[model samples]
Target chain A: MSNLAGWGHYPIVATECLPERGPVDIAGLVSAHPSMIARGHGRAYGDAAIGQPFTLPTLGLNRLRSFDAATGLLRVEAGVSIAEVLATFVPRGYFLAVVPGTKFVTVGGAIAADVHGKNHHRDGGFADSVEAFRLVTPGAETVTCSRTVNKELFAATTGGMGLTGVIVEATLRLRAIETGWLKQQTHIAADLDAAIAALEATAASTYSVAWIDCLARGNALGRSLIYAAEHASAQEFELLSNGRTAFPPARSARLAPPLVAPSWLLNRASVGAFNALYFGRGVARAGAPELVHWDTYFFPLDAIGHWNRIYGRRGFVQHQCVIPLETARGVLAEILDRVARRGSVSFLAVLKQLGPSHGLMSFPMRGYTLAMDFPMTDTLLPFLDEIDALVADAGGRLYLAKDARQSRATFEAGYPGLAAFRELRCHTGADRHFASHLSARLGI
Target chain B: MSDQKTVLILGGSSDIGYATALRYAEGGWRVWLAARDLASAQRNADDVTARSGQPVTVHALDVLQSEKFVDFVAQMPALPDTVISVIGELGDQKRAETDSSYAAMIMRTNFEAPSQLLDIFAGRFQARGTGTIVGVSSVAGDRGRGSNYFYGAAKAGFSQYLSGLRNRMSLAGKVRVVTVKPGFVRTRMTAHLKLPASLTVTPDRVASDIYGAAEENGREVIYVAKRFWLVMTIICLLPEPLFKRLKL
Candidate 1:
């Protein structure tokens, strides 16, 4: 349920794990269902955590089997949540080094997807922080893999997106922290160039990202909210909220009318109004370093649970593409120009800097990636293709992990690693059970 | 990704293929711009790098020489994510009708060559249990409008091939397949057509949506201007007797 995306609605199968306090028989389950799609807390934004026929639920498998608090080392089953890790150890002054957008994700999912965050520009993808993990391949064989052990599988499986096998247990590195709070600063950029400059200037100063207004045409084509932050000291965190038990309240969803409404109901007229409402709600000031909690700073959307329902029933498509930073300005301009030309209205768009990825099949490159969402519509393909070509000309690559409709030709042309990744798949003679609808659609 | 995750677009000089090459190059994988004219592929590669800041290599490829495709794949550091078939419609339907050679040329480029290259790509992708295949099939294939069904019929055959290839690849794992069914795209291919404002969509918009469908979601059959989906659906589902009676 947590991994559902706007592309399609599908049933979620549960994963299996031994509860920390359970008298469970691991051997029995392992023998019964040797081949399974292992999942953690199922917090993946896309299909990274779910499988169709058989899923190995790992949330209940929560248990920090071992931890050397002194050395910043932690050994946990694949199901341990980032929140749980922070709650259990942060009090004692330690934290997970690299966290994705949501702490709800499991330790295993993080390693499998090699998730990246705003700090990725400096820290690299999550795979950079991983110590090692236990993987159950499709052949029902379990092996511990790392940079040196089963190296090809290790590299491929890092960002392999669960295609290589299922992750059962993992040992991840922990970040020593003074508090669970973050020192955050937000700045507003006038346009795409200014926004990109702001991102570049502060990139080395701190973790950076910008929330762009995709529908902004002409001068404000890529207006953005640039944010940078570092972990706040424990004393500062304590003083900011006066040690409140919970985080900030979330913005409730203004639910739509209904599903299956006529597609015309969400046309440019409605979208234009929506865009105005979105853009007019921003703050003009900048430079105040607000003290914030881990959840608020990192997983802001998680607070507003089930936000996808806001799109109604047609669901939506998350279109994200990475263009080389050099051509980002021109490519983005052309893309936005085209979007405006086509009158495709989108409420919010985010543009961020992506450094080279460290994982084998990692998505981010040394470029700028922009993600925009629009309700599924009839004109989606041609409109999307126009931008697709722009990004391609800019030497951009699309992220496979998040794609729903990119064609096989575009993907093959976009990701040269597809064949290499496929080559690795050839060696592993497991059933084709590791595939996904996206993979099937793209012929991957 | 030792397979180079590299793409060598055959139509490097053309708009669609060139755009796709840049997209891949920017995403971090190396790109090989393969065009009939090696110089154009190189210039496109240089321009791609200038825009993307990622390295793009250029190669000489001739789809007409099907025998060279195997050799091309053999020399490639890796097989491409896909080989786009965006080279067609040079031979006008009316002209092709008057000249059999012109008609044969369109068929060879639109269907025969794509079939050859995909056969090679599909075999490799199937064995590996992972690969994506996309072919830009036009909405013209929806029905032989007195306008251009020769090219349309060729795209129709290519779309069918994609489905069959996808079925075969699914046995290994699954081959992601997307056959873009675009309406009157405003490209040089349809430059002469007095395209209706309502039916035409720009290249970037098509590229954006196609990129979305191909990379993010993997929608199997995407009508670029989604309205074309409805338009085509009605057209496909129209009463056959009544439709033929009107000479549409």
Candidate 2:
């Protein structure tokens, strides 16, 4: 047994770590271990991937099976990382129709979490692009699942946190692109109203996201900078003589911390200074348009490897939630007001607009979602609990992929389809054979 | 002509061998997996085919059954471009000290079976003028220790056999032979022990290192984790008087 933790690195658990490089190994592991969950790149922010006694790591099973150029369909193993897909197809004028903030996650994890990206308002969640997948059940059976076939299992497995079965492989539809660059436009919002107005103004863009200054007070409260982008077309790349045939853009080398830093390094004083500089820079660059690499525009934080270490050895909690569009402004204002009153400093605060929800347990709704990261502290849990109550009252639910702490009542109340989801789990025999710490904690 | 290649793994069900087989299959090689249990090997073959979109063939070959060696070679669909020998047994040192049969089993499994199989292929490759052989030895052969010296002795014998094979094959034809020594690999064989985190490596690292060495001709021996070469050099250089008193 080895000690393992999720991306957040909080509440470390001791479990038998099985490194599976193939479906046969996964089948053997599932049969050997009663309570086990499939882990891919360990990117889910909490205990969702950490079972009670077993964590079957799928990293070694990574392989690209096949690709249909005419249809833009790709068949890849469950452990294949998004970074691998991008490296193989980005230069060939293809891209993942939906991408999360990080490229380090695996296909299995993306489906299990049903993660949404900055383009959620237009592209939906990760499960939307998946055509079909193979699931290895605890009984050592490989079942093919798709929207039309094994409909209940398909619904339960998506956003099911690997409870339904171990994802073996998946076939996905890739979107064609003219180039590997994004044509980006930026706008500055002075306050909460201006920020929402900016989002509304650029709602038609294929991709839109905002960096909010969560600690801003009074008139500057909820100040943000919204970035909206579209895939660069041939005319947008007119600088290159060959237009659409221009060379693919190269990503800059990544940077990483040499070692873990002292826990006291990222306190309120330091974060406050950084936020001020960011806000000032945003104001100065209002309405600025630039052409950036797809990697830069979609995965900004990926430039710094193991950037989570900057949060210190104690790790950090990422709080992400979505509220109904009707109550978005009021709910967000209340949440920000509480954070300012508590003097909590979040160095990373982001906001995005979500489209209609698809997966049964998917986090998104027709609303606005905001995410923030705060270093774990004594008062952080209570503060988050308070925010959760506010979100639940507004009919908003917390994102399972990014949650490390949330009460059962809060989760159950937020997701109205929990009963149907439970029935599916029971029908699939997942309730007894597969379980994780998060599932046990929430009575799932 | 198509740029196609084929590789045969002697102990394909082993963790290290299976990982290496996956690497070869992913690189567009038709992999033939030979092991004691044909059913289990077929399952792994199916998995590799699914992952790589390449065909994989499974064969039954118990290393102890030397009498059937010639039949196994004759049944091959085509002469493999490369054949990897990843056969070994870590018999209990304590048991080996008491029973001669235990020690014999360890020696036969690690040294005799691999050497006999390679010798057969060596003759065919010498006549054909093209082939490669990868012998997976171990760093335990660098110096004798009370803990697992029997297993080490077998690997040391295999390493010497590979050295002789490389010399003769180089003089006769283009046939190449490479020996691999991996230290503290995380596999089912070492699952029961508590190993230091910094010193242990995954099977994938071993697979890539083997692939890299085979890609370049004239390479003789490869330390899976390259740092192991230096570590072994220091151990091998230690004075006999000082080394004999210490427990590893």
- In terms of DockQ, which candidate is strongest? 2
Off by over 4 Å in 2: A1-5, A12-22, A25-38, A52-80, A84-94, A136-142, A176-180, A231-254, A258-260, A279-291, A427-429, B3-62, B88-105, B187-212, B237-244
Per-residue error for A68 in candidate 1, Å, reads: 2.0
Alpha carbon lDDT of each predicted model? 0.68, 0.85
Residue clash pairs of candidate 2: none
lDDT of 1 at A116: 77
For B1-248, candidate 2 gives per-residue lDDT tens digits of 46798899998878887788889987888899999967556656765775566788888899988998988888988788899988878888999999999898998899999999988888888888999999999999888888998899989999999999999998888999999998889886886778777777898888877887886545679887777888889999999999998898
Please provide, for model 2 over A1-444, each residue's C-alpha lDDT reduced to its tens digit, 9 standing for 90 to 100: 788888888867788876555655788778888888888889888888987777888885666666777898888889989887887788778899899999999999999999888889988899999999999976778899999999878887888889888998999999998878888888988898888988988889999998998889888889899999988886786753343444364465479877776788886788899998987876776665667788888888888888888888878899999999999999999998888777777888898899986778888899999899988888889989999999999999998888878999999999887999898878767787788888888888
The 10-residue segment of model 1 chain A with minimum total lDDT is A15-24
Give Cα distance to truth, residue A70, candidate 1, Å.
1.4
Instruction: Provide DockQ values for all models, in the order shown.
Output: 0.01, 0.17
- All candidates: TM-score of chain A: 0.84, 0.96
